[model samples]
Target: MRLQMHAVKFTADQSLLDFIQAKLDKLDTFHDRIISGEVFLRLEGADSNKVKEKIVEVRLMLPGKELFVKEHDKSFESATDRVMDVLKDKLVRFKQKRNDISSPAIAEAKTRVDEEDEVYEADEL
Candidate 1:
């Protein structure tokens, strides 16, 4: 998957970028269909005393749908961690949804076959 990282109003260090890349790479384990992803890191000008002001937004592109997550923390690392959690959850849910849509028809067909087998046995008796 291609990852495009953009930092707004500030420059991100190599370590932070590496951290983000590592986190996103794990998403492939959940679903390999991910086409690409974009990460936006922004510094929000809020109350100076707030502990969480840095914002991280992640956008993931799949075959048919797009997933997005946004989080704020005191530092980019914290925000990235939170975003990774959300991305993992989203990927899991997406896989579950895809499986649910594909499994019901197969299950119904199997049930029909079982019913037909029972009828054939009854007629033979």
Candidate 2:
């Protein structure tokens, strides 16, 4: 997957960029349909307590779909981890939804077929 990273309000070092790229690469293991993606890393202004929040937004593009996740935490790593967890769940659900074979009509057809098979087996017994 091709990942385009955008650092907002601050310049990200090479290591940070590499870290993000590697993290995004892992998404291929979850869903092979991912074509490309974009990542936004922003360092929020320090609050009165001098606490800085790192915000990460990830967008993954599939064949005919796009998935997005945004999260903020004290560290970029933690935020990225949160984003990955959310996206993983979403991708799994998306795959399941796309591959669903248990529509109401299909379920009814399968039920009837099973009943017929069971009746035939009972007669033989």
Report every candidate's CA lDDT. Answer: 0.88, 0.87
Q: What is the lDDT of candidate 1?
A: 0.88
Candidate number of the best lDDT = 1
Which portions of model 1 miss their true places by more than 4 Å? 46-52, 101-125
TM agreement with the true structure for every prediction: 0.76, 0.78
- Model 2: residues with Cα > 4 Å off, grouped in runs: 46-51, 105-125
TM-score, prediction 2: 0.78
Predicted candidate 2 versus true structure: per-residue lDDT over 6-64, tens digit per residue: 98866889998898788889988888899999999987774454547989999999988
- Candidate 1 per-residue lDDT, tens place, 5-106, comes to 998866789999999999899899999899999999888874464434889999999999999999998888988899988888999999898878468887
lDDT for predicted candidate 2 compared with the true structure? 0.87
Q: Which ten residues in a row have the lowest lDDT in candidate 2?
A: 43-52
